[model samples]
Target: MNELFDSVADGLVDKSYAIIDNFLTTDEVAQILTLPHFNQHEQLFKKAGIGKNADLQINEAIRGDYILWLDKNTAPPAAMVYLNRLNELIQHLNRSLFLSMKDYEVHMTVYPVGTYYKRHLDQFKKDDHRKLSVICYLNTNWKEEEGGQLRIYTDHDSFDVLPVAGRLVCFRSDVLEHEVLPATRQRLSLTGWILDQQIM
Candidate 1:
């Protein structure tokens, strides 16, 4: 586990991003999928908005996903397990990369068919506390034809990542410009940011 953390640290140092497959075990992913919010998503989840605070707005043309924020204290056992691992990774990153990440905020996201997020950066213009973006995919048996690929752009290159189950993608929140392509089927993932300020 320490070695895995080290690999993530190394990737940040080299490329400012990392894509790690099987970050969670099959059982772990299954447990997380059992979250009650997923079952009652229509009632519990809210439309994800762009911007923050006073500037926040729900523009379906830009993005069309529903999200439910997670609370560690109230999270089920499976979520706690995942959060504990994230805490460990946070500690390791602080020690190795000096990111100074004080806390993390995460939400379960569900993108209904034909919904997608337009190209954008994760960090806010006024507030830059969000240092890192992390996404853990939970869509099992996903296929290339499904079309829900994450497209990350760089200065001279661009690539797409399929939302495969148990795959973890981490990147600098302020640096990367990315977007989610519309999928023929629904897509599911746990998406969040590691922040420099404490919110937990």
Candidate 2:
């Protein structure tokens, strides 16, 4: 835990974002992916949409994926364990960086073949409580040619963050513009946000 916390903290302090490989162990990734919610509840993963609340709309051209939000009150044991880890990370960040994060939310996401998400910032006007964006990849044996990379843009340069197993990406939600490039195979990930107290 110390290793991960320190690495993430230092990365955020230095670049406003961080990409950590081996954030989860093989067993841990298996635990998350094999849960009944993911294995048996495929119907629950509704089509993802753009915008929030009243403005939300399903536009396949812009975003193409399915998502199943982890329910805080009813998440399975494996999920609860994962969420607990995130809670601990939140505590670490609040103590070390004074991020003042009050809560966290996560969802299991899947992008089928050829799916992709257009470039956009994580923060939205009406639901601006999102302070940080975190995503953990679950795909094993991923290859460069598979093509589902996270393309993050900065003022001077842009780079691709591969969706490889056990890899984690964290960034200031409002500071970066990123997009999911099209993939040749299925892509799976656990994604979430760290929110301020005002959102709770």
| Top TM-score model | 1
lDDT of 1 by residue, 98-189 (tens): 77899999899999999999999999999999999999899999999999999999888999999999888999999999999999998999
Instruction: Tell me the TM-score of each prediction against the true structure.
Output: 0.97, 0.95
Over 4 Å off in model 2, which ranges?
Answer: 39-42, 198-200
Return the TM-score for candidate 2, rounded to 2 decimals: 0.95
Residue clash pairs of candidate 1: none
Model 2 over residues 173-192: C-alpha lDDT tens digits?
99999999999998999899
- Estimate the overall C-alpha local distance difference test score of candidate 1: 0.92
Instruction: Judge candidate 2 against the unseen true structure and give its global Cα lDDT, from 0 to 1.
Output: 0.88
Ten contiguous residues minimizing lDDT sum, candidate 1:
33-42
- Find the candidate with the highest lDDT and give its number: 1
